[model samples]
Target: MPKSLHPDICDKLRFSKLYEKYAQTLSNILLYKYGDILNPSDKVQEAFIKLWENCTKVKPEAVKTYLYTTANNMMLNEVKHQNVKFKYQQIKPKDYTNESPEFVMRKKEFSNRFEQVLSKLKEEERVAFLMSKVDGKTHKEIAETLGITKKVAEHRIYAAMKYLKNNLEELNKK
Candidate 1:
């Protein structure tokens, strides 16, 4: 067992000291396990908050277990909520009526062009763009999902849009 799992000499765990010691490690563990689905850092912070709230009940030696359990439960709830949301969205009908044939044709052409341009972008940019535009994820959500900063996610999405716009303009001329 790791020494970190054991209690220190002091019976009561200090929030600031405990956070300083374990925050990054806990975040890394959650990220490694659940990065694709949710924001690990947010979950880690939530776990710590829960720990702080229940500090008196938790044994110092069991703090690590408590954190992991809290984080896992929070993630599970998020997954369940996402699943319900997905199911509800799946049941919603999409409307395509009241459109001219020419408009539909142009839309199809634009979509094809968009796909082509997106494929040509760098992998990171393409991913960010797809997550933001196609998947309808916000910049922060994309950053969390990709384990990147929000600014980086925004930049990648912007670059992708610029690339697509330039390519689409060139395509129009051809």
Candidate 2:
């Protein structure tokens, strides 16, 4: 934890050299992993800032892992927040042949009600559920992205499904 890197570490991670060597590569990795869901450039910048703040504590050899892990965690949190906020706002009807007006209206009504129920779920449960159901992520994938155990991911999704089912049934009864 030296304020200035020791000579050996400095060779690998001099402040200026660090960005030149690693920034674009890290950004590319995050972009590939997250697609358009996150701003890779922004996440990369944030990770660099964190790296700078913890420079003394981070070993030069481990800097790449540190940067990637930080950026990935940042992107995951941003994706979860944005996914929830943007979910219902961007709904679009799929193309269908000769649908009746009543059917269309009913579909919209059901969608709106489902969105309401989803919004009422606990944040962790909602995130897990949407990641699994909407994004087509498996429990293992969701666990990795969210930095949780697979068991936790499974429980969260199950809890979310139970809530949605019970609430939707109540809505239907009404």
Candidate 3:
């Protein structure tokens, strides 16, 4: 008999069954880590989506690990975003009037350029970059969560930062 290249869960029926079997466990894991602030059910769905997207790469036995890692990463990102939003909300609207027209236009331009540069990053680089910058994770933590080598994660984050810096500076000079 030949060994299968993909996990059994890569099949639709098997994947659905796996989801049914592990969905509660995934939700509970998220709840334990974050209480209700992170939306465990929603994170569970997102983890399953990721699992399906990477179905061929995942081994059947490691499903739990994969789900747990992704769920934790997702929660961390959400927490960062929530903190930023809360801080922004606390600022008085009077701060908006302090910007000169020139500053406003430049700020808008820079934001557009930043989005474009970010969009240009490869998926791997973007993931590593956001994990490092947004979630404030170390290379080792990023690698363990992403299931990549620490060296690879470090390289990806470096490449992403280099790309963003070079592109944004060049764009601003124009």
TM-score of each: 0.44, 0.46, 0.48
lDDT per residue for candidate 2 within 1-174, as digits (tens), equals 545346333333477798887776567556645655579889999998888888878887777788888998999999998889897688676777588989888888888898788878887788788777766779998787666999999999999998898988744354
Candidate 1's error at 128, in angstroms? 26
RMSD of 2: 9.4
Off by over 4 Å in 3: 1-98, 170-174
> Clashes in model 1: which pairs?
none
Candidate-wise lDDT, in order: 0.75, 0.79, 0.79
lDDT of 2: 0.79
Using lDDT as the measure, the top candidate is 3
Which candidate tops TM-score? 3
lDDT of 3 by residue, 1-174 (tens): 566566457889889988887776567546645557669889889999999999888888788788888987998889898898998687555446577989888888988888778878987788778767766779997787667899999999989988887887763354
Which parts of model 1 are misplaced by more than 4 Å?
1-13, 90-174
- By TM-score, rank the candidates, best first: 3, 2, 1
Could you tell me which residue pairs clash in candidate 2?
none
Model 1, span 1-174: residue lDDT tens: 455554442334467777887676566555544454588789989998888778777777787778878997888888888888997686545656689989888888988877667668988787677667755779997787566999999999999888887788854465
Task: Report the error of model 3 at residue 53, Å.
Answer: 20
